[model samples]
Target chain A: MLAESLALSALLFTIGVVGVLTRRNAIILFMCVELMLNAVNLSFVALSKVHGVGGQVFVIFVMTVAAAEAAVGLAIIIAIFRHRQSVNLEDINLLKG
Target chain B: MTFDLLNPVQLSSALLPDLLLVAGAILLMLMAAWRPDSDARQRTVGFASIGLLVLTMGLVVWMAVSGLTASDKGVIAVDGFRWMVDLVVLLGAIGTIALAIEHNVRDGIVQAESHVLVLFATSGMMILAGARDLMVVFLGIEIMSVAVYVLAGLNRRSARSAEASLKYFLLGAFATGFLLYGIALVYGATGQTQIVEIGNAIRRFDLTNDPMLLVGIGLMLIGMGFKVAAAPFHMWAPDVYDGSPTPISAFMAATVKAAAFATFMRIWYEAFYNMFSGWAPSVWWLAVVTMVVGNVVALSQKNIKRMLAYSSIVHSGYLLVAVTAASALASTAFTFYVVAYTLATFGAFAVVASMQQLGETDARISDYEGLWHVRPWLATAMAVYLLALLGFPVFGGVGFFAKWYLIQAALAAPAGLTILAVILVLTSVISAGYYLQVVRVMFMKPRPEGAPEPLPVGSLTRAVLAVTVVLILGLGLFPSRLVEMTQMNAFPRYPFSPALQMGQPQFRR
Candidate 1:
């Protein structure tokens, strides 16, 4: 059971990573990051059955932190959108080296 | 005294400084919101934040002097290393707020909330300095990164600032994902979240060769690599530093990096000491690449802020040498190096902040041409700061010794990182290419015709420069005092007690 669940979690995490790399929309990139975090949460939940409650407790902390990050991340996206009228990564090029 | 975190009262007391800072930050947040945003309100809150940081520094020193320790089951460290890093973080915060109070008026950032955010971020850094558990480390990093994300965009009037904020937020969150997954996997492998317990588990269970543990450590390294802005993972840094307001850039460069590095060292040294063979080579490569990339790229930079950002990256490489050493002396060296680097970084950025004209963001290296002709003292101080960053002897003061100790630590490691130490030297010489270019521009070039004189140095900024300059030179001349202090504060080696382990909850029930 643990092996199957862990394998599923890894698959989800890899998909999230690929999405973040390929997606140019700012909001999509952030959603992908959340997806990655949730994938890790799944692994933690699966591992808790093998280990102890620590993994389960870590899942709660991850969720709380991810929520906080979502709040800040959305507010930042809004701030940028106010200036450029677009949430596309390619358009956010005012700070290039 | 030792803290037993399982006891509520002891946990609270163990967290006294962090609690105090958080409480103070909340009160200041209320004060910041009491009035509509204005320069006066921002300045008032900025000063109050400085006062609060100073008070917290006092408490940290008191705790360090009383020699507090944490039991093995505790999730927070109460040791000399934490106290020293806390002092550096608080000092950086104080300098940052002082510079921001004056610089924000010029940039038209009237939000008092910016200073309050710095306080909140600082409290987070304090938490990071002492966090001995993976969960606390995650919380601390998130708190610090979230506040800094907003501070980067505090100049709502500037699209550049907003862009910087967006990029930092996205990359920072991505890094957090890798870090969290690493923690989850490590937890799965060893069934423990506490760093000491993980170490004990690895030793007791002989999990050194376990694939799960190795991959977990690798992921954690990648995540920390991004945070410290080591190269390959450092693509976000130069842009973010260039676009953020100058004082915010200084805060990110100094205190934020210091806190992150402190936690990074603690986790590696305390938990993974037995796996030194497995990790040292990876870190050795990281140090070398970070140094070479930072210096070589900085050489071609036209913008002064970007150049400093790259220089900060190079310093990260040097600190990584100490990490690779993974010795008690390396921690001491890391502490000393962080102090010197913080002072020099704040001083350089103070000069950068002062040179800006109202509402302009021109920080080109060319703009500093012949500064000596107009403002001799400021130009000379900039020279001192740049030379220090270059790690020049005598004039660069503590900067010289910072590198000296780092090299010593690298060479003295049991792994004998001779090649890495040599690369460190070669890269330091290459870094001189850009650091000296700035010095030459300030001293040798003639003033451009009809160039407007730089604004009068604000009193607050002037004080910051004077203090940093004096300390850099004084400590440069008499570094033995700091050397002794750092040596005394080195990470306690193998503070693992069987009695304390018995108190910990079993992971493999």
Candidate 2:
């Protein structure tokens, strides 16, 4: 069970990384990051069976941090969108110089 | 593997500075939310934050002087080393706050929240500096980074500021993911989250070759490498620094680097020393590329903020050399180096902040042309800082010792870091090429035809600049006392650390 769950968690993490890299839309990119974080939580839960409750405890903390990050991250993304009328990463090049 | 939880009193005593800063930040937030209308209240809030930082600095120094040793059951480590870092972070916060006052008003940022965010970030840094467990480190980074991401975009008027904030947030969140994943895998491999316990597990269980452990270490390196703005992982720094408000740029350059490096060293050295031989080579490559890329690439940058951003990256590379050496001397050198970098970087940014007030944003290096003719004092201050950064003879006093001890630490270690030492020397030369350019523009170039009227220097800014300049030269001239102080304030080891594998033993050696 641990091995299979770890494999599934790793697969989710890989997809998250791929989505973050490939997607140009800012919202999608952020969602991918959230996906990556959740993937870590999944692995933590799966590994907790072997490592004890420390892994479970770390998951709760990661969840809290992830929620905080999402709140701040979305607010900033909306701020950018308001200025540029788009949340596409390529459109946010005013600072590229 | 069993451990005991610390008592509430014991924990509070150990965490006094962090607790105080948190309370102060909450109070400041309440005051801000209370009075959104009055400029007088805003000024009061700013002074209040400064007073809070000063109090925290005093508490940290007193604890250091008293030689208090407070470790809380392998979760938090409080000793001279942690206090020394706390002092730097607080000083950096105070300087940034002082710089922020005028800039915030000019740039139309809500003044009270800026100060509140910085206080919260400094508290997070305190947590990071004292953290002996992976969980604390994670929590600390989140607290610090989330506050700063908001800070970067505090100026909602400028579209670039929003861009910078968004970029920093996305990249920062990505890095946190890498870090969390590393922690999860490391825990899976070792069944532990505390540093010393992991070390003990590695030693006893012989899990060195576990794929999960190795990959976890690599991911953590990438994550931390990004946080410190080392090359290859430093894509976010220049754009973010260029776009953020000037004082916040200074804050990010000094405090963020110091805080992140503190945890970087604490985690790698304290928790993972058992795997030192396994990991040193990867760091060797990282140090080399970081130095070369940071310096060589900085030479092409026209924007002063981007130039400093790259220069800060180079400084991170130099500090990484100390970390890769992994010696007691190296850690001590790292502490003094943080102070040195903070003084010079903060001083330079102080000058930059004043210039930005004179109506220059996204300033080019050439904007410095004829600055000497206009404001010789500011020009000279800039010279002292740029020279100090280049580690030139007279002003580089602390920088010289910083690099010298770093080399000495590398040399003292087995022959592994010889190449890194050599590369460090080579990159210092490469860095001079750009530092000298800024000096040339300031000193030799004739005053430009259309230069703006000089900005009046704020009293608070003047104080920060004066103190940093004096300390830079003072520490440069009389470095040994500070060196001895840092060396004496060795890291506190966990109870589970082997007699042969701990910090006090290194001092005895």
Candidate 3:
């Protein structure tokens, strides 16, 4: 059962990576990053059940960090959009060649 | 088994240095916020920040002294390597703040928040230096990244600064995703995240060849590559260094790079050492590509900051050379090269800050024409820095020894190390093309009319440059002392040593 859950978490992580790579919208990409974090959280819980304790603690910590990352990431995205009036990766060419 | 929160021994041993920095950061923040309008805010921040750093230095010294007598904590790993790196990080932070105080005030950016940023960044670096677990490493990286993002874009009026900050943020976030996922995969394979435990599990399970572990390690390397701006992942560097305030650029080149590399060394050498054969070749190629790209690209840069940015990339390549070698000699070389590079890079940026006129125009390479005639001291300082960057040895610079150590490490590799050595030597020769250009333009070329002359050097800036010059020259002359110190403080690469590789050696006939 634990192996199945862990496998499911890995699948979700791959989906997140695919979303991040395929999506062009900055917001959607960031959502994919959050999804990746959530997948890790699930894996951490499953592993905690396997290991007895430490993995669950790590999962709690990971969630706290994910929340923090979301706050900061959104704030930065908003700031960038405010300055340029766009959130598309292709539109953010002020820094590129 | 209840843990006591207020345990005196735990507080004294495990948490004091971090506590010192956090307190100092808050104090500087409050002081800065207290007088947003006062000119003295910069001074206050400068003195207070330096004072706090000095105190932290004392604490580190105390820790080192006690560590000699104390037992090791596998969870925290306050070992020789951590102590050595902490010293380097603190020194880099102090030098950067010194430069920042002068640069900020000159540019009408004397907000205490600048000081706050330095303190916060230093704290983050401290966390990174001591982290023994994946979670702690992630936290340290976030703290460092957020502060740097603010520092990069502090000058809101400049479109370039805004662009630099955004580029850094987006790329940095992407890398963090790779790192987190890598950690998950590693956890899957090893069922542990502590560096020591991970190594133990890898050995005990004989899982070095496991696809999951290999992918996880590769992702982690990619994540670190982005942070260290290794070849292919270094897109943000030139623009960010060119656009940010010169002092912050200096900070980025020195403190941030040191912190990242410190963690990289720990992670690669400790948690992942068991699988060195799998990763060393990849990192070896990374080192070669990074050196070649950094030097070759720098040759065409007309802007001094951009040139320095590329030079920094080359320096990262040099450090990576040491990383891939992964021997006692290489670790020592890594520490020595880091010190030499930090001092020279910061010194070079300090000269840039001194040469920059207040809000007048961007400093182009042409801006340096006839610098020798106008300000000999500043011009000479820039020349010294360029020579150091080029690994030139006249007047006794340690850059030569730093490279020698790297070569020594490459030689220690059982095979194919000669190719790394050849690439390193070739890149060093290639690097001279750009480093010499700075010197030639400053001294050889006739003065261009309307080019900006060096501004009067402030006391803080001058002092910082002087100290950096001394350290560079001193280290160049007698690097053995520093090398020995680093060796003594260098973290042990363990478990996966001869013991783990006994059954599955890479070079077995």
Candidate 4:
């Protein structure tokens, strides 16, 4: 059961990687990243149950950090959207290839 | 709160510098918010950040002196390793603030916020250097990453700046997830999160070939690779550097990289030393790929900012080479290399900051044409930096010695990491293609007609450039002492020690 949970987490992380690479909408790409975080949380909870209380403690900490990251991430996204009026990742290429 | 009759201090003395930085950041934020409309507030904020940094430097010095008589505390190790990194990070912060003064003066951006962000970032970097636990490492990363995300977007007028901030925040968070998951897996396997505990667990269990541990280490490396902007994970670097304010770019390139490398070394050397054979070979190839990709991509760049962005990536590869040889020279080689690299790279970016006009100005290689004629001293300073980056001999640049140590260390591996040395030299030569292009345009080519010369440089900038030049040349000529200093500061083990195997099973899980 622990192996299955970890495998699921890995699968979810791989999906996030694919989204980051392929998604053009900046908002959607960021959402995919959040999905990745959720997957990590799932694994943490699963591991904590199997390994005793430390994993649970770590999961709580990860959740706190995730909350902080979400706040900052959304703020950055909103700021960029206000400036460019678009969230298409490719369109925002003023920095050049 | 639960203590015996004697209540021990929760805060480690090792964290004194970080505490000062945190307090300074909050104070600056309040001061900035106190007089939002006043330019005086901004100036105060800038100076306060500089003052706070100076105080932290003093604290670090005091700690270094005190550490001689003190024993290691719990999870937090404050050997020569942490001191060497802290010095580099602090020096980078000083130069960044100097470069930022003019940029903040011209733009009405909340200069105080910038200072606050930098303070937070510096504190984060220090904690990163001193982290003995996985949780502390994660905390340090977030604190640093959050501040940097804001700094990247500090230039509100530019769409590119905002875009860069968003991209960096998202990707950074994404990487943090991988890091967290990796840490979780390691904990699950080892039943411990403290690095030493994990090492002990691994040794007792003899889990060297565990699949779970392998995955965890791989994921952790991916996360750190993103932070250091290693190749394959470095797609965001050029755009982010180009988009952020030039001074912030310098800070990101110099201090953040040094801080990240510090933690990278600590974790690898202290926690994962038993797995050195497993990780080093993969990192060796990653270093080669990062160097080649960064320099090769930079070669075709027209914009100087973009070029430097790629240059930063190339530097990461060089640092990775040092990391690949983490066992070499008691980890002092890593610190010396970081110091040498930070001084040269930050000085180069400081020069780049001076080249820009008000708002966002494009500084192409062509824009530097006849710069030697217009600003001989600035050009000379930049040339010194470029020479250092290329590890050239005329300047006796320490970059050469830094590179030499990394290769020598890598070669120490029973495996032929000599291949990595050959790659380092080849990639370094490839790097010359882009670094020298700037020099060629600045000195050899004539200034473009009717292009207004850059505004007179600030006194602060000149002072920074002068100090940086002196350090670069000093390190180049007398690197042995610096190397010794780094060695003395590093944990007194070079190559993996047998004791490290004791903790292998904990890390294996």
Candidate 5:
């Protein structure tokens, strides 16, 4: 069971990385990041069978941090949207050197 | 088994500065939220936040003095090392708060929120520097980063600042993903998150060949590399550093790097000491690439902030050299080098802050020309710092000695870090090319016509510059004292020293 879940988690994480790499929209990029975090959460829960409560406790922290990151990331996306009238990463090149 | 747990009182005392900072942050946050946004009220809140940072520094100093090495809760490690880093973080926070409030007043932004954020961020840094558990490390990083994400966008009026904030948040979150996955994989491999326990597990299982564990370690290294803006993972640093407020740039470049390096060293030295063969070579390559890229790219930058950003990346490479050496002596040199770099970097940024007009940073390198003609004292102070950054002899007391200490640490390692040391020296010379260009522009180039009048320097910024110049010279000339202090505080002492190579057991066979 643990091996199966770990494999699933790895697959999901790879998908998330692909989404982040290929996506241009800021909102989707953040969603992909969240996907990656949740993928790790799955691994933690599955591994907890052997690791005991430490893995579970860490999952909680990861979930909470993900929540906070989402809130902040969304706010920043909105701020950028207002400025450029878009949240596409392509349009946000005002700072590139 | 020595990990203490369930002692609330001892834990609170162990966390004295953290308690004060949390209380102060909450107090300031409440005041900022409830009070009307007015200049006087903002000033009051800003000054109060600076006062809080001072109190935290005083308490950390007292703890360091009185010998507070309590490690309750199984997650904290309050030692001389963590205390020293806390003091640096606090000093950095104070300078940043001073810059934040002053910049806000000039830009008409209410600064109370920035003060609160800085206090919270510093508390997070202390926790990070002291963390003994991987879980605690993750929490500390999240705390520090969430605050910084907000602080980056605080200048919502400027579209560029907003873009910087958005970009930082996106990439930062991506990095956090890498870190979380690494922790998960490590936990899966060892079933342990506590540093000492993980070390024991590795030995008991002879887990060096465990592919899962090796991959986990690599991922964690990548995650941390991104945080410190090391080569190949440093795409976000220039934009983030240039777009954020200058004071925060100074803070991030100085204390954030310091805290991240501290944690990186602790995790590797304490938990993975026996696995140096697997990891050291990768870090060596990172050092080479970071040094080459950082210095070479910096030579082409016209914006002074961007130039400094790249310069910081090069300094990160030097510090990474210290980490790769991974000896008690190396850790000590790392600490002393951090102090010198923080003082010098902050001092340079403070002088840059004086060049601000109406809240925007006019950081074109040419703007520095004829600076000596108008503000000789400020220009001279900047030169001292630039010289220190360049690691020039005679004038660069701390910088020179700091590099010397780093080389000694590299040479002390049983493995051949000699080449890394040689590369570090060559990069220092390459770094001088851009660093000296700045000095030349400031002292020798003629200020072009239509040059803006010199902005007024606040008494507070002036004081930071004065202290930095003096400290750079002091640390350079009398480095023995500071080096001795680090010698006492250094962690993961001789048992796990890189010279021992505890993993291989037969090096020359």
Candidate 6:
């Protein structure tokens, strides 16, 4: 059960990483990041069965921080969307080197 | 006396500076919201934030001088290392707010909450400086990064600022995922979240070669690599620094980097000291790559902000050299180097802020051509700052000694990083290519015929420049005093030694 859960968590994390790299929409990219965080949360919860409650406690912290990150992330996306009518990453190129 | 954090009194005492800053930040946040947002309100909040930072710095110094220490099981460190880093972070925060008060008015950023956010971010940095557990480290990084993410976009009027915020937020969050996963895996491998306990577990269980632990460390390195803007993982820094308002850029470049590096040093030195052979080579390569990429790319940048961003990346590379050293002296060197770098970075950005005309964001290197003819004082101070960043001797001031100690630490490391030290020198010479180009433009190039005179330096900014310049030069001339201070506060060599862990004085006066 532990092995299977770890494998599932790793798979979800990989999917999230790929989505972040491949997606060009700003909102999608953020969602992918949230997906990655949740994947880690899954790993922590799964690991807590063997490692005691520390992993479970870490999961709570991760969730709270992820929520905070989401709030700030969405506010930033909204600010950018107000300027350019699009939420596409490619269109957000005013700061190129 | 050793602090047992389970005792509420001891925990509060151990966390006095962090608590004071957070509590002050909350009050200031209320003050910020109480006012109808205006330039006056922003200035008031900014000054109040500075005062709060100064007060916190006083507490940190008191703690350091009084020789507080925490038990090995404690979640927070109460040592000279934490106090020194807290001082650096607080000083950088004070300078950032001072510059912001003036810069925000020019950029039309009237939100008083911006100053409050700096306080919140700084409190997070203080948490980072002392965090001895992985969970605390995660919380501190998130706290610092989230506030900075908002601060990066504080100039709502500018699309570039918004873009910077988005890029920083996305990349920062992605990096946090890697960091958190690494923590989870490490926790799984060693069954401990406390860094000191992890070290003990590895030794007691002989888990040094455990694949799970190895992978966990690698992922944590990658995550930290991104935070410190080390190469290959540093894609987001240039754009973010260029687009953020100048003072915010300075804050990000100096204080934010200092806090992240402090936590990075602590975790590696304290938790993974037993696994030195496994991680040193990876860090060595990181230092080398970061140095080459930062200097070479900086040479071709036309925009001054982008150039400075690249330059900051290069400094991160230099600090990484100290990380690779992984010695008690390396931590001392790191602390000294961070102080000099913060001063020079803030001073340079202040000059950059003052050079801007109202509402204009463009700052080309060409604009600096012949600035000496019109603003001789500004030009000269810029020279001092640039030379310092270049690590040139004497005139570069404390920057010279900063590199000197770093090289000393690298050479004296147990691994004997001779080749890395040599590369460090070669890269310093390479860095001179860009740092001197700016100086050459100011001193040698004639003023453009139609150029307008640069605006007079604001009173607060002028004070910042004067203080940084004096310290840089003063410390440059008398570096021994600073060196002695760093030596006294150096990260303990044997972190787990019972004598040192028992709150005894580790260094002689």
lDDT tens digits, residues A1-97, model 2? 9999989988998999999889999999999999999999999999999878998999899999888888999999999989999999988898764
Residue-level lDDT of model 1, residues B255-344, one tens digit each, is: 999999999999997787776667777887898899999999999999999999999999999999999886667888989999999999
Highest lDDT: give the candidate number: 1
Model 5, B1-509: lDDT tens digits are 12244487766677778888998799889998887777777778888988888888899888878865543336788778888889888889988888777777665577567778888888889999888899989989989989988888887888878887887888888888898898888888999998777877887787878889888999898989889999888888889888888888888888888888888888887788777777888888888899999999999999888889898999999999888886777888888888888988888888887787776744788888988998999899888888888877768768878878888998886675888888988888888899889888998988789998877888878777888898899878888898887876787344543334444332220
Write model 2 residue lDDT over B333-428, tens digit each, in one string: 788888889889989988998887533467788889989998888998899899888888776667777777777887786435677788899999
Pairs that clash in candidate 6 = none
Per-residue C-alpha lDDT of model 4 across residues A1-97, encoded as one tens digit per residue: 8889988988997898799779988778888888887888778878877777877777787778778877887888888889878888767777767
Candidate 3 residue pairs that clash? B80-B489, B81-B489, B81-B491, B397-B476, B398-B476
Cα lDDT tens digits, model 6, B30-104, are 999996999988888888999899999998889898887787778888888888999999998999999999998
Off by over 4 Å in 1: B494-509
For all candidates in order, the CA lDDT equals 0.91, 0.85, 0.79, 0.79, 0.84, 0.90
lDDT of 4 by residue, B1-509 (tens): 21121214544444668787888789788887776545566667788889889999998888786653223235465656776778788888877877786677555465567777888888888888877788889888988998899899987877878878977887787788788778877887787788766766776786667778877888899999999999999988888888888889999988898898788877887777777666776777788899999989999999888888888899899878777765555266667788888988889888988887776546677778899889999899999998888888757388888877777776774444677778889988898898888888889988889977787899988888889999999878888888878877777643345544343222110
| Cα TM-score per model | 0.97, 0.96, 0.93, 0.94, 0.97, 0.97
lDDT of 3 by residue, B405-478 (tens): 78888888544377778889998998888888878888988888776556688888889888888887888878
Which candidate would rank higher by DockQ, 5 or 6? 6
- lDDT (Cα) of model 3: 0.79
Best by DockQ: 6
| CA lDDT, candidate 6, residue A43 | 89
Q: What are the candidates' C-alpha RMSDs? A: 3.8, 3.0, 3.1, 3.4, 2.1, 3.5
Superposition TM-score, candidate 4 onto the true structure: 0.94
- TM-score attained by model 1: 0.97
